[model samples]
Target: MGRVAVTGGTGTLGRTAVCALRAAGHDVVVMSRRTAPGLATADLLTGAGVEAAFTGADVVLHLATSRGTADRWQTQTVVDAVRETGGTARVVYTSIVGVDKVPSSYYRTKLRCEDLLHASGLRCAVVRVTQFHEFLGDFFASQRFSPVLLTPDVPVQPVHVRDAAAALVRVVSDDAVGRLPDVAGPQVLDGRTAARAYRDARGWHRPVLPVRLPGRAFRAYGAGHLCSPDAAVVDGVTFSGWLREQLGSAALT
Candidate 1:
């Protein structure tokens, strides 16, 4: 098994991927900007210590992402560092399913990073996935103090982070690379339904207000841009199952 280096190993997805890789019997090294234990100290933002982090890595999972347009710069830095080392590593990047369809700034930056990797002259795979269950949970969390939970009126398929990580593990071992198929959870539900399920799972009765804005991003979301029902390479766990696991089976009552 070759050494695998994961950037942003501290992030939710990154951490799950690292565990999956290790479980698959690959030697894994975690690359992070922080000086934490077991992390190969590296920063994609300033391009510091990346070379050392990627040293001897046969496959690099470039899962490190930041807010705004920082990915454009961080991605370029990754390309440079990998190319400088003869470009032997295969990069399995984690991208969102609706990056091309969504006009949001974050999605656009992810698309740009995908472009960079494609032209970087290294073996790479752009694996797009739908929103994670935790991401939706975070959205609900953001509205915790609100009197009413406002959810976008659109369909969502939220995959578990572990499922997403397992799909990535398959991609890492596959010889084929570049623009891989999308991956997502097993169930699709409207935002209202999802929010209600979340509320029920948490044993909380709250007013779920469904809202639709006129923005292109919202419209795109309403059109199911966040769903990958047709193109998923890996069909994963259902949202209800994930909720049950997190909140326990009794919470669903």
Candidate 2:
């Protein structure tokens, strides 16, 4: 049981990670930008309170992420805080699979962050995972208002966030190993099929239309750059199974 500081501890994956760490008897310190009881306020985006949050931590689980261009800054700030604290805490970072291959700005920042962590001269481990089931759900939900759900033609293997969180905790508990095996869901399907599955799960009868995404990013996805079939460590929960649980009997096959 080590004293661990988890940045973005209140977020989707971070919440599950913090729970798992605490359940395993680790002294957990939650670091976020918001001030709340039992949680430390550390703005990774601004470098405020980071030193105090990471003080005396054995491991720093860096999980903060952004969808915009500020992603790299957030990660660099974490690295700076770790160096500034003068502590020997191992940094465990959660990343997405295929960041190196994807052409998106967010993914590129993630790749840069990986490089930053490697050159920081600290004990570090990076665990890359596929998109989460919840992320897909949200994505589909956002486009539901249209007459038809316009889905991308790319393939996706959506891992359960809880499973990803568990893998992260395991890495944190072990010796720091750089760039661990990629974690993914047990099944892979094209966006149309995935969207159909989600639609059925929610009992939404809207038709799902497959639309081709343009540019190098879409090409990379179409080329299966987002998938790591051989290197993927499969999690037990399939997207269908998780949807069934969430929607109860309403979820279809």
Q: Please write out the lDDT profile of model 1 over residues 1-253, one tens digit for every residue.
A: 8899898788999999999999999999999888978989988888889998887889889888889878888888888888877789898888999999999999999999999899877899999988888888888878877878889899998888998899889888776788998888777789988888777887776799999899899999999999998754354667777778877844322
| Reference-based TM-score of each model | 0.94, 0.94
Would you list the C-alpha lDDT of every candidate in the order shown? 0.85, 0.84
Output the number of the lDDT-best candidate: 1
C-alpha lDDT of residue 64 in model 2: 84
Residue 111 in model 1: shift from native, Å?
0.8
lDDT value, candidate 2, whole model: 0.84
Residue 60 of model 1 has an lDDT of 89
| Model 2 Cα shift for residue 90 (angstroms) | 0.5
